[model samples]
Target: MKRVLLSAFSLLMCMSASAGVTFNPDKVKAVYIVRFANFIHWPQESSLKQINYCVIGNNQVTNLLESILVQHQVRNIPVVFRQVNNQEELDDCQLVYLTPESCRLGELKIDRLGLVTVSDERAFSESMGMVEFREKSGRIVPVINVDNVAKNNITIRSQLLRISKIISTPQGVEHD
Candidate 1:
C-alpha cells in the first residue's frame, strides 16, 4: 500500500508540472498574455484586419511565444510574429509583449494607441494595457490591468477577468 501511494504521489507531481505553463516563469507569463489575446474584444474601428503579435526587446520570450502560438489560432486568424525596434512599428500589432528593457518604449506607444501591452516588469503599469506576471509562493500568476485595457477601448471578456487578478481603476479616468 505504501508503494502504491508513493507511485500515485509521483504521478500527481508529474501531472501538475505538465499542467503548469510550459515556459520559464517570465516567458510563461508572456505566453499567458498570448492566450489572453483570445479573450479580448477590440472595438469595430480597431485595426484587427490582421492578427499580429509583436515582441519588443526580448528575443527569447518572442521565440517561446512564437512556438506556443504556432499551435493555436485566434478568431480563425493566423498569428504573425514580429520583432519591433521602435514605436512606429507598433501600430499594426494587436498584442505587444515588452521586455523590461523595452518597457518605456512600449509604454509610450501603448499610451498613444489602443493596443494591448504586456510585460513582466512593473514599469508597464503606466501603459495603456498590461499583463503583469509575478512570482508568489513559488507560483507564477498574472495580474491584469483591466482599467488600462478599457482606457484603450479594449474589452476583456468576463471569463478572463474571473481567472486573473484584476487591477481596478476608476471609470472615466482612462484616456483614449
Candidate 2:
C-alpha cells in the first residue's frame, strides 16, 4: 500500500515535470498539497461541489498548485486555489496553505474550524497548524498535528499518518 502511494506521488511529480515545468521544491510542495487533500478526510467532502485550496499569500507554490489542480482533483471534486487574506474568506476552504510571513504575523492564532492548515514554515505544526512541510535529507516531510486535525473533526487516514511525523498535540511530536 505504501508503494502504491509512493508511485502515485512519483507519477504526479513526473506529470508536472513532463509539462515543461522545472522540478523544484515549490513543485514538490504543490504536489504534496494535492496528495494531502486525498489523504485527509474532510467533513462533507462528498457533498461539496469542489475543494477549495486557500493560500494566505501569493507565492510560487500557490501558482504551481493552481496549475497542477487544473489536471487533478479530490475524490472527483475539482480542487480550486484561492488567495485568501482573512478568516471570512476562509469559510469554505477545505485546506489552507500558509506562508512564512503569515506565521510570523500571528495568523496561526486564527480560531477557525473545519480547515486543514498547512505550511512550509518551520515549527508550524508545533504552533497549532495541521501540517508543516519540513525539509529532511533534501526531501519534504509532512509533520502532521493529529490533535488539530481532530479538533476540526477531520481525519487523516492511517496510511498517511503512518508515513508522516505525527504530532499528538501542539507541544509534542510522536512517531506512528
Candidate 3:
C-alpha cells in the first residue's frame, strides 16, 4: 500500500513538472486536491452524493479544478468546482481552497466538520488550514495540521500523513 501511494505521489509530481500551460501551479494544486480525496476520509454522515470543491481565491487553481471534473472522482459521488464569495457558502463544500488573503482573516466561519481546508500561507499549517502548500527546494511541499484536522472532525489516512509534511505534532489528544 505504501508503495502504491508513493508511486501515485511520484506520478502526480511527474504530471506537473512543466510550468503553467504545460504544468500549471494551480493545476498542480488542483491535482493534489483531487488526490487528497483518495486518502482523506470524511465521516459517513458527512460524506455526500456530490462533493462541491470550492475556492475562495480567483486564481488558476479554480480553473484547474474544473478540468478534474472529468479526470477524478470520489466513491459514487461527482466532483465539482465552485467559486465561493463568503464563508456561509462554504457549508456546502467538502474541500475549500483559500488564498493567502482569505486565510489571513483567520476567522473562517465555515464549519470544520468534514471539511478539508487548504491554504498557501506560511503559517497556515500552524494556524487555520488543515493542509498547506509551500515551495521547498523548488517543489511545492504539502504540510498538514493533524491536530486541526481532527478538531474539524476530518480523518486523514496514515499513508497521506507519511507523505505529507505534517506540521502538527501528536498533542496527547486522542482522535476518533
In order of listing, the candidates' clash counts read 0, 0, 0
Per residue, candidate 3 scores C-alpha lDDT tens digits across 1-176 of: 33444475566676534555254456567668877886787875344877788888766776766755553456666777888887788888888888887776756775477888887867776766788887775567778888888888888888778767876635422233
Better of 1 and 3 by lDDT: 3
Question: At residue 147, what lDDT does model 3 achieve?
Answer: 82
Local distance difference test values of all predictions, in order: 0.64, 0.78, 0.72
lDDT of 1 by residue, 61-148 (tens): 6777776666355776666777887778988887888877776553455653457777777634534446776666555656777667
Show the lowest summed lDDT stretch of 10 residues, model 3.
167-176
What is the C-alpha lDDT profile of model 2 across 91-132, one tens digit per residue?
879899988887787844444666889999888888678899
Local error of candidate 1 at residue 39 (angstroms): 0.9
> Candidate 3: what lDDT?
0.72
Error of 1 at 124 (Å): 2.4
**Range of the 10 consecutive residues with the lowest summed lDDT in candidate 1:** 8-17
- Give me the candidate number with maximum TM-score: 2
